[model samples]
Target: MKDQITHLPDNADRSVAKQKFKITNWPTYNKALINRGSITFWLDDEAIQAWYESATPSSRGRPQRYSDLAITTVLVIKRVFRLTLRAAQGFIDSIFTLMNVPLRCPDYTSVSKRAKSVNVSFKTFTRGEIAHLVIDSTGLKVFGEGEWKVKKTRQRTPSYMAKVASGS
Candidate 1:
């Protein structure tokens, strides 16, 4: 008689393997990314000249609403890569800060709440498309802890997948 069951709280083996792929050549990676495209831009001469006449002197009120570019970058990446709230927050804090967006990055909870029910109706309604979605093939992982996966012999397997991880 024998009891054959292997149970552990976490996978220590995988963690070590993951650490091997550290970002050693981050500078090179940043240069390569710049070649692809960058969001930075100053107003062009012609564009600036044209808008000169249309500029208003000033609006008498409290200071205008301002959010850090980091937040916007995170939001944009979330839409582009279709990341979950937590992942989106992570993506921002990890790589997006390199862009120097000039604002304090919001915590994960702040990003989550804003993304779920932000004032997006205006933008959605103003878009040219009737359906409001140009290309909509995407998946979402809705769990905070991420996936539970282990390799049997190198093939990938999905234990579970969700669009919105519970416990928001």
Candidate 2:
């Protein structure tokens, strides 16, 4: 029995493909780009009032100073900036100072404890609205070895040197 090789048909016109999507609303796109860097740290009066009013004490423990919303906000800020819990607390404190808001920011311990119970909600577009999403991804290979083991075990030999040393 003989094996047969199959070949795909090739196109002669090898031209670069043009982009399919075009920006229709430049102003909206520009505004979105601008707003991406603008982090709104100032809490509104309603939010402040809600936070203050949510300090009702439970029967077993002391009164809560921070609300779930406040803790969730701190967690969101931490995630957005990729900050540690301590760093997030400091960042929130700085923002509060900058905004001159007379509200107490949650400590790192409080934020960590409340984060597990905080309920977060994200806004969704209506059914009639259409959203275009473009996703791009790159693959990364990870080695599951400690740095010390990797350094100790790593053997470097050129391909020619390896071939010659093996007497091949």
Per TM-score, the best of the predicted structures is 2
Give the TM-scores of the predictions, in the order they appear.
Answer: 0.28, 0.48
Score residue 126 of candidate 2 by CA lDDT. Answer: 20
Instruction: For candidate 1, write residues 1-168 as lDDT tens digits.
Output: 899988865865566543566778999989966754433222223322231124343877443232322234345446645787678767655543564444244666655554554332112111111111111112112211112223334643432222321111
Error of 1 at 54 (Å): 26
TM-score of 1: 0.28
Go through the candidates in order and give the C-alpha RMSD of each one to the true structure.
15.9, 22.8
Clash pairs for candidate 2 = none
| Number of clashes recorded per candidate | 3, 0
lDDT (10s digit) by residue, model 2, range 1-168: 889987755754675688798999999999977764553333556566654435456678777787665676666556545699899888868876887878776889988886666654423222211111111111111122132343676953221100001000
